[model samples]
Target chain A: MNRNRWLLLPLLLTLLFGFSLSLGSVRIPFGQILTILAGGDATEPVWADIVWNFRLTKALTCLLAGGGLALAGLQMQTLFRNALAGPDVLGLSAGASLAVALIFMGQAAGIRLLYEPSPWTTALVASGGCFAVVVIMLAIAQRLRDNVSLLLVGMMISAAVSSFVGILQFVSKAEEMQIYIVWTFGSLGSLNWPEIAVLTATLAAGTFLAIRSAKALNAWLLGQHYAQSLGVPIKRSRMIIILSTCILTGGVTAFCGPIGFVGLAVPHLVKLLIRTSDHKILIPASMAGGAALMLFCDVLAQLPGSTQVLPINAVTALIGAPVVIWVILRHPRMLP
Target chain B: MSPDTPTIALQTHALSTGYNNPVLHLLENMSLTLHAGELVCLMGPNGVGKSTLMRTLAGLQRPLAGSVTLEGGPGMPPEHQVAVVLTEKIAGVNMTVYELVTFGRYPYLDWNMRLREEDKKIIGQAISQTRIHGFTHKKLYELSDGQLQLVMIARALAQDTAVILLDEPTAHLDLNNRVEIMKLLQRLARETGKAILVATHELDLALQTADILWVAGKDKTLLTGLPEDLVLQGTLDEIFQLKGYDLKTGQIYHTAFRNKTVALHGEGYLYRWTRNALERNGYNIAASTPTDVTLTIEPGDRPAWQLRRGTATNLYYSLGELLKALPK
Candidate 1:
């Protein structure tokens, strides 16, 4: 079952990715997409720009953000032994959004910048917010003995950060508010080359760490005590899991503006389809599942043959929520 | 014929264990020994730190003061040397029985996590030892409590430890499964030559099955002895506060005596059972002192009970009819 589905995931990811590249308001032909991807001139010269500059970058962004967030969610669910735990559960995304909001609001309202800010500066500042939350969470994690309480504390932190973001939203000008609001809506087409490369590096590092801890993660399913008995160094493995999750979610939230649903929904969806809790199998499967789901949602977000594009966050929650609910209801063990 | 000298597998030297944060001491300065190839049951009242003691012995928690040693080394034993089965249930997991049993080899596995042919053989032996081969492919969520307990035991066996500590492995199991697991533990101890320590509340089962009994009471001490010796010395009774039940005669607790005393006369198995029936119905079976009523059991292919009340006498073929004829 795993072998067949393992092949199915990458296949789905590839198909959805290229299929999404061919879709848009102009609706480029599949042959033109192949020709443009193969470094040849398309029948229509404008097709290459739309494909390479807009659709191609957007598709790759979806893959990285989706796959990275999905793995983070999987790690959180296993670390906390919770069905609902995700990247957002720990408030890393919330933290990033809060920092981004503050940076946006401060620039226009008398908190002048010391230097010229690049597009990459936003990603870095957003990560500073994530690092702050991760530090505070790691400190609390040390004092707390169990995962259930840790999840509750994470939720509370998210709530507090959200309220802070709410305050920033309230006392802002129309233009500043629109910038923050559009960032919150989660865009995938905003990235240039350097941003994508940085996102790729973070995703690769996070994935590597996740794979290294796969053995410990499998033991974690038996729970902490049992995992300890099985010779899993509890503290070190715990630190690694949290760090990996933070890096993965932090990178995505910084670059993609807190895209919702893929992190929370993809692992459960993968587990439902793949039928194994072994992290050795689960991590890669979640990676593929997440990337495929994101590209599919991105295609829908494009709203083909229409000029207007829907928010990636809206398309994700609207599509991912019902599908997750259906999967959880049909196969109840998916949550656990 | 020579008598074999048993080797001690695990021992505690004046060990004191409790939580460190609050400076709470549960068991203080307690020394205990567990011999190899023995099934020892640690029986205690609730809140008397049986679990705390178990955790300390298994090295799950640190001892407050003194040390617990395995093979004369004072520290936590090697994971392969001391296997522990906690009371925590593995719930809603998609792991197969075989996969979990093989997980017992976790201590030996490196980052690769690939099991060798030898590890597979050990896992197979564990499954066969606990008789969980039938469900080797089944998911954990599909197993019953009895099956899951057996799987847990198999995992411990696969650990191939010198000592195995289980905290109430038979809890929430049916009577048949309880007996089956206890008997299996006894067999495993003898076969594997591992010291098995079970901390449980099943007094009756422990008394019947354990090679030695470790009874802990409110005084923070473990009184260890043979099962019969513990019962005879009144340690079990003292520890449990056996008020209504008689541990010596195996009598069930009954509230009503009703002041009705009968001199029951019989021999062997028939005599004990007749007394049980009479005693169960609020009738005191006197040993020697005679009352106006006397009941004698006539043992044969079809036994009969002869009941006498002063000059009036009645004979019933069965104890049931004789019980029915008694005055309410």
Candidate 2:
């Protein structure tokens, strides 16, 4: 019965994304938006720019970031076997946040950096920082056999990084603080074409690696000893999964700010829906489900007839928290 | 003996087993050959490394020193020759019985592999053989512990290896389930001609069921022989000390008696039934009698009796038949 429902997913996603582009304080007609998207002649250049440059990119950014975060989140959940495990839980997002904070604070202090940086350059640096933090966490996880202990260590690292960001925020000037605050709020609107290109490339690579590790992950679901018995190189598989999660999450955080909940919720949703732990189906299902969710949430963030736009995190929290609470109430045993 | 005697199904050539750097050996300088069509039971007390030895044999954990070799003859690779059912529960609860059983195909599958018709048929057969056919669609978490155990055994069966190793497969089961699982293992060994090795603490059941007893003693030496042979050699008494003496029949009990005064007159099949029932209900049954009852009425007669000034109800027949008249 639900198989037919799956067939409707792509159609629903296209409709949701198309409808989301027309939303905002200044409403653009759907036909004109389509015309502008097609790059044909248009009546208003301003409206064309607004639809083509702003909403389209923002919507696409949400789709990609949502999918990427969800995939990473699902991977982390499986690896740790903890429902609460997410890419953000490992402090990767905090790493990006801290790096961005440093850049803003340094600029505010009137220090002339060696490199002339663009927004994309800042994103790249942030992604590098996130990668470093993930590497550290992976190293620690490898040494610790206990999953809860590994989670606590990751939480401690996240806390430490957040404190450092706090210190940076304290020393920064008002204008710099404003820039940092806006970045922290997390907006899909800020990703330009260059950042989108980078995001797409990183997501593609991470997804490919995840797919390759699918069989190993299935073996891992039986525990490390069983996986080893099945001829899986546990350490090597762990490394690949960690690397993929870091790259995918780091890229999203850099370009679109640290979007939350999508990763944590999307995998669970896929598991709940498909009713199987097999990653062969799960990985692709999570990607599609995550993309649709992000697009939906982004559209909700820009409520029609309102001048004010909601923070992406706030929108995700609004949607994700209820589902999480419901999941907890229904199947409390699944929680670690 | 010839050097090549159709190579034993599983052999530990001077194998020493332990965990974490091999500081303390569980079984040292141990060498044994288990051939196909044998049911071997590893009997020992707790912490005797029966589980560890099983793990070593299953290739889940490495021995501290020495090696385990699986001789190829039963249509399987040497590496894939052993299948294991450990005491630990399989991790995933969301998986169906069918899916869990199909995982036994792991060693046979290549990258990007799908289940073949042959694999499906084997899995289906295993499910049926384990008597878990009705629960195929049920999630593992929904099944009873005994049912889950059968599923695990079915998974091992699906692996289709020559050597099947079970580490305390009956550890948590009730007596009935324990005997059922043991019988299943025995039947599998006989029917499929596979070597089945089980490590268990149920000495009486193991003695009755196993073809060969692999006794792991406190001295860390493994002795393998027929069950009756081991029993006759005082191995069972040496490992599990006999405690009580019977002065009348020269019979011994592994446990000491607390209350030995109660006895009644009984004889024949009815007497046997009464004895078994009384024993099960925590009353001792002895051959000699301390009290006698007179049967003076017909089958429908209910007479009165006296025991220490208290009157009790009685039945009419031979003492054995009267005892059988009591409610079960």
Candidate 3:
């Protein structure tokens, strides 16, 4: 079954990615998309500009957001042993949003220290925020012991950060608030090459770490004691899992607004489709599943013939929420 | 074959294991040796630190004081010398029986986690030894408790260590399953020449199957000897400190003796049970024949009981009515 799925995935991904690039407000032809992709001039200058500069970047953004979030979610689920666990649920995304919000509000208030930060500065700050949350979570996990309690604590931390962002929204002016609100809506069409480069690097690093930890994660499925008996150094594996999750989620959230549903829903969706929990298979499978789902959702967000694009988060929630619900109702014991 | 004389697979020198939170010390100054080719049972009451000692021995937790040493060769590491099977269930493990057991070779696997032919052979040997080769492809959730326990034992076996430690391997099993698992472990120990240390609450099974008994004795001490020797030396009784059960005869004593007395005359198992019924009904059983009242069992095609109270004889078919009619 997995072999069949593996054969089908690339074709599906290509078809969806093609659909994403083709059916926008401008409605570029498939032939022209191929021409532009192959470095030739399209029939029209406008088509090339839209296809190469805008649609291609947006499509790649969707892939990165999808794959990175899904892998991060898989790592979090295995690490915490909770099916409901995800990048957003653990407040890592909220941490990134908090960092971005602080900068937006700081820039709006004319703060000299941060004074009109660049996209790179924003990404770094977001990573710092994510790193801080992971550290706090690790500390709490050390003392807390129970996975459910730790998840609850993560939810509480997210709530606390959300309120802080709420305060920032209240204090900011109309223009700055609009920018932040639009960011919170999550957009794929706005990623430039520089931002994509940063996202790519972070994704590559996080994916490397995740794949390396696959064996340890497999041992972890039995749980910590049994994993330890198998010679998995518990503390080190945990640290690596958390680090990878933070980099993946934080990097993406810094570029795209906190895209929901992909992280929490994709792993379960893949597991449901494939029926295996081996992380060696899961990490890559999640990447493919994540990328496919994101592109599909991004196309839905585009609405094809319509001019206005839906918020990626909204489209994902419309689909991802039901998948999560299905997972919960169908496999109640999946979560610890 | 004394424990000290035999080749030691694992040993502890004055080991004291406990938690630091409340500054509570459980076992202190405990020195013991676990010998190869022997099945040892660590028996104690609940909260007597059996798990603590097991974890300490397995190197899962640091002992409060003292040291645990494995008799490994110069090149062999401690992890290669010992393997542990914990009571913690492998929850949500989405792997086949084969994959689960193959994890036992983790210490020897390379960074790529590619199993060699030798590793596969060891895994196959482990599966066959634990008799779980029939379900090598089946998921863990599909197995029963007994089968899962065997799979875990197979995992430890695949580690190919000199010593194996299990925390309640027979727990959550029925009588027959418990006996089967115990016998399997005993066979593995003897055949493979690996020391097997099992911490369990099943006293009867332990006493019946274990080659040696390591009783966590009263007041933070240790007792190690043969199972019969421990039983004869009263160490089992001291360690368990059970109130109603007699360690020597393996009989339960009803502590609440009534003022009334009864003399029962019967033979064999029937006599034993009749006395038990009378005793449970608050009758002080007289060893010699009594004059006031006496109960007699007449066994035949229709078994009956007769109660004689000053020649006013009453015959009852069942002991229940006989006990009920005895002027309460």
When 1 and 3 are scored with TM-score, the better candidate is 1
Cα RMSDs of all predictions? 2.6, 5.0, 3.7
List of chain B TM-scores, one per candidate: 0.92, 0.77, 0.82
Model 2 per-residue lDDT tens digits across residues A56-121: 888889788888998898888877777778889888898888788778776655554424556777
Best by TM-score: 1
| Least accurate 10 contiguous residues by lDDT in model 1 chain A | A109-118
Find the candidate with the highest DockQ and give its number: 1
Instruction: Tell me the spans in candidate 2 whose CA falls farther than 4 Å from its real position.
Output: A106-117, A141-149, A170-177, B1-7, B21-27, B73-79, B220-223, B234-273, B276-328
Off by over 4 Å in 1: A1-6, A107-110, A113-118, A323-335, B1-5, B72-77, B287-289, B298-303, B308-318
Worst 10 residues of 3 chain B by lDDT: B87-96
Going through the candidates in order, their DockQ values are: 0.53, 0.37, 0.44
Clashing pairs in 1: none
User: Candidate 1's residue-wise lDDT over A200-236, tens digit each?
Assistant: 9998999999999998998888888788778788888
Model 3, span A198-314: residue lDDT tens: 899989999999988988888887777777777888877887887898889988888887888899898887876666767778888899889999999988987844798888888
Ranking of predictions according to lDDT: 1, 3, 2
Angstrom error of the Cα, residue A335, model 2: value is 6.3
Distance (Å) between predicted and true CA of A72, model 1? 0.6
Would you give me the overall lDDT of model 2? 0.77
